[model samples]
Target: MSDIPLIHFLIVAAALFSIGLAIVVTKKNLIGILLGIELMLNAVNINLVAFSRHDPERLGGQLFALFVIVVAAAEITVALAIILRVYGQYGTVEPDKIDGLKH
Candidate 1:
């Protein structure tokens, strides 16, 4: 079986990260931004796993990726909770329209 090149993994990861960044930058809704962040995290995981493949003895990269996944899950849970609260309080999910926390 032919091995896939590291460059190929890097390119895919880069593209995923870029798309995620664009989504985060252009999105107005809090949920959209959260989705973008998740994408970016997944991209990092892809890169980590790809590099880990080279060193079969040491599983550092894969270990780190697993940690990242756990953290991302926690982050998203908290983020969604915040979003839900914001939506309930303000009646809108758009960050720009939320204006003040005092209200």
Candidate 2:
């Protein structure tokens, strides 16, 4: 098999980021928005890993990616907890109808 090109990885990562952005912008459900955020985070991680391929040190990108992953995990936990509370209070997870915060 031929070695994968860096440009190919970059293009795929870009596509993923765009799709995630679209999902976040268009989705009306809280869970769907959360998933799109996760997908965008993953696309960032992919770009970091792919760039680390060129650098001999390779430490910077990998470290940044690790930080991103840890932050994403923390975000997911907190967001999920909030979403659960919202669901309990409102009986639905639609983002548009979550008007309790506006007051």
Q: Which candidate should be chosen as best, given TM-score against the real structure?
A: 1
| Model 1 per-residue lDDT tens digits across residues 13-65 | 99999999999999999999999999999999999999999998999999999
Q: Per-residue alpha-carbon lDDT of model 2 for 1-103, expressed as tens digits?
A: 5778899989999999999999999999999999999999999999998898768475788889999999999999999999998998888999778777632
Model 2 residue 38 lDDT? 94
Worst 10 residues of 1 by lDDT: 94-103
- Cα RMSD of all models vs. native, in order, equals 0.9, 2.0
Count clashing residue pairs per candidate: 0, 0
Candidate 1 segments whose C-alpha is farther than 4 A from its true place: none
Clashing pairs in 2: none
Best by lDDT: 1
| Model 2 regions lying over 4 Å from their true place | 101-103
